[model samples]
Target: MTLDLSALPPRRGRLAARPPAVPPGPPGAPGLRRLGLDPERDGLVLLPDGPGPFPLVVMLHGAGGVADGAVRLIAAAAERHGAAILAPESRDPRSWDLVRGGRCGPDVAFLDRALAATFAWLPVRAERIALAGFSDGGSYALSLGLANGDLFAAVLAFSPGFVAPPDYVGSPLVVVTHGSEDAVLPVTSCGRRVAASLDHAGYRLAYHEFAGGHVVPPDLADAALAAFLAD
Candidate 1:
């Protein structure tokens, strides 16, 4: 179903739709499928190998990255934990709207549509939804997750540069991972600063710094998913 932007609040970064009470039955078959929401830059969804009201993670791709690669980062871990993945392509070719415009706009709207479609097509646990991303995508995830915490129960940002939410909403659990030797966006100025800000804002945050470059380690990705799906 197409999302009605007018039905959503007039806020800069707010999403309107929530999970439906009685979702249309006959969920999609297990495996990956293109959302076909947009013709040029459609998104992708990966379902686990069993019938379940599985946990969901909405993943975002970094600048110049696509949904296909972003979904692969956590595909193995998600399969192991029986979670579903919804990776949406950004409206902008370079990065998310929030990163480019300093406020959420088209990307937010597209993501809302993507989530609405995913909820309708999958057996998802309403309370087990999380937002996660890498690099610029990570920053977008943090910003959008904070703005729509009512929808996302947790956020996992990998090597995010900053957090600039148009507005804050509910309080969701947050996990941030960064490399100490990140050349693109340094740890001290980026990840550390972001963690400090979240902590000062009284948000529950788990920050981890590793010795590497701008990349999400497999172990850390697994751990982040574990924390996100934990009871």
Candidate 2:
């Protein structure tokens, strides 16, 4: 069944203009088993954890390109939330095709494959699945979430860099969190501007700017994420 975005809880900032979620095809449907893309070659799996039959989150790395630090953090977060996690390695250092000016190549096609592969490989619920990233990864999440609206439940970007606005979907849930004093990918350059653009675009967004800089504060991340993900 198509989901009613209005049924979801209210978030901070403007209401999201989300496209209706595309319902799952069918049990063991061929469409469900294949997105017919590839990620194993260019994408890397970090740490995997969480309970069975839960929502899956595909974590893309920042400019650092799948650093061990990010892998550990995302693994821990997935374990804590009981959500399955998949972290794909960037082809280049701290890059996700946004900087290199390559379209329909590895970076763009990577997500398409990763989503299909994860959906087929994991035993999680599709409706609850999400895409999340930090920095460049955050930008990718926004891109993928908007482009593949029917595939993701939510899009979370932490200190994201430049992002191209997506055509308005119905009540899309967008979460942008950034520290007020970030030197790397400054809040002003990343989160704030994106939030404003999303606001203007009519997306349901939760824009959070904490006092700190560039890092996801544990307390704030937990609280805000909880509220953001709550049904």
Candidate 3:
């Protein structure tokens, strides 16, 4: 068989597309459900109790696990702040796309679908939406949030390694947190480099270096949640 690489379509970043319109979930539906194209993976969406166009934080989990305890903690905090939290697993069970591949691939599509579902099912304050993640997921969030800044108003990256995007978009507010004692990703190489690049690019950032290892402190999570909800 003759090979014709040229016949294949070019590998390019896909523009965000709107998902099919659907009404909000049933009033008493379970908070977390298995929906969307990928049924094996599930996402958690917590809507505020009362009527509200609430702020939202779309979170991406670290490499290796499902949504972590910090995600649940953030959800609880968001509930108090009247904000909503949506956390989706990566298509690749092991790690996010940006961690394995440089730029976005199928993960971004999953995120777009999740975002669409979130908006359709909840009353979101579109102006206050933020994208947040930790570790490899943090790297992916930075890349995606930068590429789709018109949709994400802010980005919360915790201990991210690098931000690799084929293109750039609007300037969204950013917050980064890294532990000086982190051994998994290392503070000097990953966090500092990412923060410096974002700053050099003229993006607004609030960075914090704590005295811990590869863990998200409750206080730091609170700070990040505050940053995401700030006006």
Candidate 4:
């Protein structure tokens, strides 16, 4: 089914003047799975013990990434910043639309639903919302976040490979982190290339290179979360 990704919650900034989202193909068409994700039920939504209106970080997992471990890894940092975590499972259990980009697919539709559900029932500060992810998810975050800049004021990409945005939208601030010793998606190629491109495009970007591999340290996650939740 084609989901209405329009009607995003209102925010305080002027959105970019971009056309509406068009399905590059059938909205829910399935493709071959390459990386495979662990079984995820709906999206794992984690909120602090109590809250009125909290910042929200829409987190995406790596390729075939574990849901429990992924959320547990970042939940503490997000909570420390009084932010809610909306961890949506890609419709595909293997990977995200990062392979192609957010043109049209079931994963994008699922994201539309996830955002709608979050805003409908959760206490989210629409203006403070962000799109973040790790590995493949991180790459996808860069693509989708830039495409929906008005909706997501900030974007946090951790150890990303590349970005594929079919079109561009409003300009949003971005925070990118990569492991200098990353073997899967090496920092020299993946992270550096993406960061350079985003910088060239004139988007407000913060790029960080750590001395590790394809992993998100708590400190890195905390830093990204803090920046995502900041004003």
Candidate 5:
């Protein structure tokens, strides 16, 4: 079933939420505008650089992870690749799991608003949007990409383990990489498991295993991470 990206239907009869506050940029220095997709719930700081209609990369952070180092590093990496980024800070510093199978927080609706808000404010090409995430953020990317397949052209997941929502209709190009020796999330059960599910579903997927564990490899290209993104 092909998805229609032109319109984002509200889930459960709810409107898109507003984006969170844009981080202040060097007091008075020209910086990113606080672009709100949904009010205070989901949003990314629009750090506008070169010009308009550029590719947008929406980033999600790790579990028990704040919008701090992990997010900043991922954003920096995307910027180096000449892509604009929107790093959404998760509501809980712990997990994206909504109280053990109940959908109550992280406010999925807010994420929808975040994307819409960026499209409206940033000079980003709507169809060129990419989704990337680390740890918990990666899980969100997996889940959201499946749910809103048409919204993202590609999905990049780093150290991602699990994504709920058993059935995925939209087939966004997927790139999943994990460390063979990962102990923090058990690659055998987590990354490998999810990869298998995607594979069984016949989706366009790229799965990679690194020598290291639980950390983003600095040389992702050598591990074919770049190739996945390029495809």
Candidate 6:
């Protein structure tokens, strides 16, 4: 299933663009920078140091979270793996579109644009692109990643609240982690339930339940990235 942006229907949850060839220019400078795509709610991309065709992880923030915090969650692990990070701000102030309104639209479109810009600016490994998030962002990652599995090779959802894909495409590797004592989105009703649903739907799943609150611990973050980047 190849991605052709022009051939895609006007579906709310579908992503029609593939990783494009890196344009001719000086190598993209490493470290974080604003995407500058949007004036009010812009996104951030953290470029990896050294070399070409680095792995890219599209990180999504939790409810009422911003790009900085989202990137921070995986920054160290991403650096260790030499992976680029693209963290986009939601169009809505509080949370992602799909999580809040039960439909994916503006956020998907904005993400597409952000990804396109990233591809144009840096050399990204097409097969190493992954979608990841925390809490509400985790839920959105599952929804969008499944819908556009051809574009994302893996989905790392930490403490996801639910899974509601507009449509399932390719079968990407899935890793779901949840805190046992999470009060915001409980493990039983949210993360475990999500993992079960995906397993029942025949997705390749790796579920981890930790003893803590609604947070992505450093060890889990490292392990998740290792799994996603594993050959």
How high is each candidate's TM-score? Answer: 0.95, 0.73, 0.85, 0.80, 0.76, 0.93
Distance from true position, residue 148, model 3, in Å? 0.8
Which scores higher on TM-score, 1 or 3? 1
Ranking by TM-score: 1, 6, 3, 4, 5, 2
Question: How would you order the candidates by lDDT, starting with the best?
Answer: 1, 6, 3, 4, 5, 2
Off by over 4 Å in 4: 1-41, 100-103
lDDT of all predictions: 0.89, 0.60, 0.74, 0.72, 0.62, 0.89
| Winner on TM-score (2 vs 5) | 5
lDDT of 3 at 44: 70
Report the CA-based lDDT of candidate 6 relative to the real structure. 0.89
Clashes of each: 0, 15, 0, 3, 9, 0
| The candidate that achieves the highest lDDT relative to the unseen native structure | 1
Could you give candidate 2's per-residue lDDT for residues 142-217 as a string of tens digits?
8666665555677878788866633434455788888888998888767889999888878778888989877766
- Alpha-carbon lDDT of model 1: 0.89
Better of 1 and 4 by TM-score: 1
Model 3 segments more than 4 A misplaced: 1-37, 68-70
lDDT of 3 by residue, 1-231 (tens): 732322333234433533224435443432554335466766777656665566778888888767544367466667667777788888888888768876567776676666766666576666788888888878888988888787788998888888886668888999999999999999999999999999999999999999998777778877887877773
Query: Could you give the C-alpha RMSD of every candidate to the true structure, in order shown?
Result: 1.8, 9.0, 5.8, 9.2, 6.7, 3.0
